[model samples]
Target: MHNGKPVVLVVEDSPIIRMGAVDLVLLAGYEALEARDADEAIRILESRADIDLVFTDVQMPGTMDGLKLSHYIRDRWPPVKLIVASGNAILEESSLPAGSRFFPKPYNDHSILDAMARMLAS
Candidate 1:
């Protein structure tokens, strides 16, 4: 379903952060869906098979955090790309998939957009 401009999902409980991510995706010409938490994100992904990328905040106010969500996405949808952003900047790179990315919170908008472009291109 992803020819060029693929759908992106932004899953973050923070309203500001989710809006920022959604704005970046929209500005980049990719369709985006925003969810307030991991549960909502999971429901949306379950229904929307066209979603090509997932942007999740690592610290969510729920039983399943971004790491768990990433694992679930990789297990269920191997083709979907995952990007995790958080204040936990010291995450081990080896724990994530080769192309999967992790960014620290308060990331510059341009940097995140650039990373998104790189991910989508690949």
Candidate 2:
């Protein structure tokens, strides 16, 4: 096994979106897991305990949205890197916490993979 490769967790309400994200991550030579929403994301994160990064959407139809999900992850896994992905202006218009990243929708796969590489590197 590759010891230094990142472990990615993708959280998107839409199955299509989640699957697409996971495919990209896998293609990039990283390990990946998926969740339909924040709840599922939390469950997976809690269980795996080795996730290095999370890619979440800001807008979701669920009890916990992406912003709240990011906060929850930050609180629980302070060392885990977080990446916010969405087409929502509200999330992008505001500032993000230190060490976190945001990528607006319609993001290029190469760009996202590059960013993930950088995040995991740190």
- Among these predictions, the greatest lDDT belongs to 1
lDDT against the true structure, each candidate: 0.86, 0.84
What does candidate 1 score in Cα RMSD to the true structure? 1.7
Worst 10 residues of 1 by lDDT: 89-98
Evaluate residue 57 in candidate 2 and report its C-alpha lDDT on the 0 to 100 scale. 90
Candidate with maximal TM-score: 1
Q: Can you write out model 2's per-residue Cα lDDT over 1-122, one digit (the tens) per residue?
A: 13677789999888888889999999998898888889889889888877998999988877888888888888888998888888865464345655788888877888888889888876
TM-score between model 1 and native: 0.91
Clashing pairs in 2: none
